[model samples]
Target: MRILLVLVAAAGLFGCAALPGDGPAAINITTQDVEDSAQSGDYTVVTIDPGNIDAIRSYRPMAFANQFRGVGRGGSPTLLGVGDTLTVSIWEASPDGLFSSGDSGSSQIPSVVDEHGYIFVPYAGRVRAAGLSIEGLRQSVQKKLIGKAVEPQVLISLRDKLSSTAVVVGDVAKPGVYPLPLRDTRLLDLVAQAGGAREATYETVVTLKRGNRAGTTRLEDLIDYPENNVLISPNDNILLSHRPRTFSAFGAVKANQLVPFRTKSVTMAEALATVGGLRDERADANGVFLFRYEDAELVRRLKPELAEKLAGAETVPLVYKLGLRDPKGFFMSQHFEMRDKDILYVSNHPTAELGKFLQIIAPLISNYSTVQRITD
Candidate 1:
């Protein structure tokens, strides 16, 4: 009997608090409340009220920015390899020191970087040359030719690179790591290397990771601002995630529900198409709604809050909603961006909230009575 009652209460908790009539109900969430909770340093659900879009747009997290750019900075130091090229020049050495000295137009041998990331010298043996920079490799050769020739002067450089690579995964055309053959590999170059993201993916949502941490960057931003189109670094990993497909449709809609669609990037018009749309036959189109959760707390945090609220409840719903179709009704679908684990709900037509409340309570009471009777 006790177990039965507990189960009943649990179900009631999830399906309760419904408003009056058939259509969705009006939802009210205050920006002040969210801010106050945030200021208190509580990592709880920071319910973003309808008017908070501007705040979200302007909000910047420096931690996230630093995480992405860090990838290009921590690669392992190594030598150049095969299929590599370099342009070498000796400062004050004689004809033999510079391959073709005095700009003679090189009548003898064709000078070019080798495929093995190495360069050949007249008497210096085959010195490894691929990975190192121009000055870096130069010092290396200078060190190697100590007693070989008369003050054997040496200078080595990377004239051409042929061993660069990067990995692409998640939502791209061909999800795998690829090799790049140039020192100057751009963001778009990698995208091309991977064959681009899948058709179901949002091209704008892409992330890059160096090691453990990752950062998000927009495709448009990289195109419009070349600086964001970062240069590729060796051993760097790029992951592309697909946006979630769930949305909330509320207000004058016939049935308010958390609906799941096949793809992400859903428009207000498309969301409406699901669940039979605004019960124009019975709903108020102007009052259609979608309640989204912005900055919802993780599931772990919700459990403690529910325990405190219910005194000893086993579980609780730690979710908050913001209605979109209220003031700037039409803007609901356009400006709203859906994220993972988001909640979408259509509001009840005025009278539905009460009916929902009664329906929820009735189930609980009946469940309790049935349990008691069975026990007796």
Candidate 2:
């Protein structure tokens, strides 16, 4: 009972070491006296750079697909352009005269709007067709010919409509501005016309610019739901882009690399699969480490202190170290839920560092050789 009481007191003392009363030197992992006797020239202190240490207090993923959800089916006004053909029918004129109207068999010259955005008629001379629709341009011409002709009546309709086409660039197979027909075309139909996002990665994000205003949206969101595939207006610029994915993984892996997640959520097993799994020969199966952030004091803060506090009571919470050598561990990997920017590290034998060092140095040497060849 006396020995048990002594052990309990020692455990309580160890717990007090983290409290505020533990003095300034308590931050050191080991005592100076112990370091001096160890004789291996004192252990190298690991200085944690603030930049390298990821502190997860409050973090949210960047907004995505918001613009896609808000796309509407409304059609905006469109302007007329050159190379457009129009059929004009005028009253009180013969087939050989200045104005004439006949059946569909009549081979009349389809009035071509010139580079100056104007068309020439016998009575009206040259008039601007740039900003005016077919009916609007015809009405202006009819008003101009009223004094010259006997109460002139005019009708105009588009014969060819290839002058106005919206440009769709980037990521699509065959990207170009396609001419829109009589009815308003939806976003998905335009994508189909351009051969879709052939080179797009994961959730493809696209930008649509109409006039001076621009908005972004995901292609998948529009494709997945019928609502988002709304009508695209004329003069709208569509851009398809593959945004880079950013993530980092560390610990007892063969090669640690910052690979693209290409997804919203990634499993621990999938993360391991990305780095070619743990080094089977050198890894310590029992020392796998997953480091995540904890801000408990920040969670339970007073209202007054919350305003000024950057952060409080930060900790590197670790997860279970599975013995994958055992058969049951393969199943345990399924339960692990990986958060954004979390580092999953598996511990390994000391010699594994040599492989890591060589892997890093080889790239630098190769890059130096390439520079020499280029200079020579």
Candidate 3:
């Protein structure tokens, strides 16, 4: 009597929004919203088939600049610059010269490269030293003292350097400015100088901002590709960001959690297994969906029509459907790679909702039946 009325009311509520649901049903998500929409929606669903798998891949495995060639050979970064302290030593055969005094035939004079890129000596009046090497300035001083000194030999030593320095910030053990002595100093050398990155090579993203033209590459790419380990330039900023790639699993999956990518990349099949696969009792095999915000250029190649609808957009919202009911779907999943921030959601089976509803009312029905018997 009471149990029957409650059962009827619960059933009526189940058909409405009152029934417990982990997420929207497969059909409602797939079509119902668009069908009853007052305006067109921002997203579109596409089936994952053999024809679209290749077009779906926009993941940048290596973002390094392909044409990036490091500094030239023979170690050419010996040029002088402003704010450098130099020790100019001049040696003469006789003790009586411009840079010689007492019984010594040599003298060491300290000079700082001025703002005008010049250094002054007693004999060599205002010679350019900023753009020239130490040897170049030494020769210029020697030439100036040719007639003044007896067999003069001039030598210049750099004391304090302030021009050829680079900054290393972000996920390094040491984040500060470092001097780059040689022009051919590679990326690996710079990273080592900073006590290496705080994170693993694969998990870290290394960015190079050089003047107006900036580029980026994975730390793994620098180690693997010898050419990608570009030379460090002065005023360059190298940032090692500890950005680990990850994807999320929700709905009918065994674990609704964020899954980290251990390696450089992981296939869709591997991602599914990592999250414990789909829930057998509740999962709808036909409704395995992947949600992503794809680059507009990739969308143009796959669905030109959709791309046309969303003109001048940088990224487009996409929902990719994969049906595991077919045996072919298993092979397709193996080749479909998972991108960072991608979402894997398996819809619940329709009968699973009925199961939940029945479980909720079972205790009420049993208690009511027991009361009816006692009253009788």
The Cα local distance difference test for each model comes to 0.53, 0.57, 0.78
Q: Root-mean-square deviation of each candidate, in angstroms?
A: 11.4, 16.3, 5.8
Q: Which residue pairs clash in candidate 3? A: none
lDDT tens digits, residues 1-376, model 1? 6886687667656655422343334343222353344335332343334555455444332333445564565332345666555555543344554343566522132234566555666555676766566567778766766665445555454443445556888777888756655346766678877887665443446687666766676554455456666766766688776654456555556556777656545655566666676653334333443333322223223333432334432222333434344655446455545544454454444444445555667867887788879999
| Descending-lDDT candidate ranking | 3, 2, 1
For TM-score, the strongest prediction is 3
Clashes of 2: 2
Instruction: Report the lDDT of model 3 for residue 173.
Output: 99
Better of 1 and 2 by lDDT: 2
Please list the residue runs of candidate 1 whose C-alpha ends up more than 4 Å from where it truly belongs after superposition.
1-66, 69-122, 128-132, 135-164, 169-186, 198-207, 216-231, 241-244, 248-252, 255-270, 273-276, 280-328, 331-341, 353-376
Worst 10 residues of 3 by lDDT: 67-76
- lDDT, candidate 2, at 342: 66
**How much is the lDDT of residue 332 in candidate 1?**
42
Give the per-residue lDDT of model 2 (tens digit) for 268-369: 678788888877765666555554543333222311233223233233132324456565555556545465456666665544444444454566567767
Off by over 4 Å in 2: 1-76, 79-109, 112-117, 122-124, 141-155, 159-165, 177-189, 200-218, 221-237, 241-248, 252-255, 258-269, 272-376
lDDT of 3 by residue, 1-376 (tens): 6668976686758644576666766786678343222126466677889888766664443235532444233122678998788898889887766667776778989999999999998866888898898788888888988888789998888886666777899999999988777446777888899999898888888888777656676788787677678777777778999988899998898999999998877988899899999999889988898889776666666766555566766566777888899988988898888877899888999878767777777887789889989999
Model 1: number of backbone collisions = 44
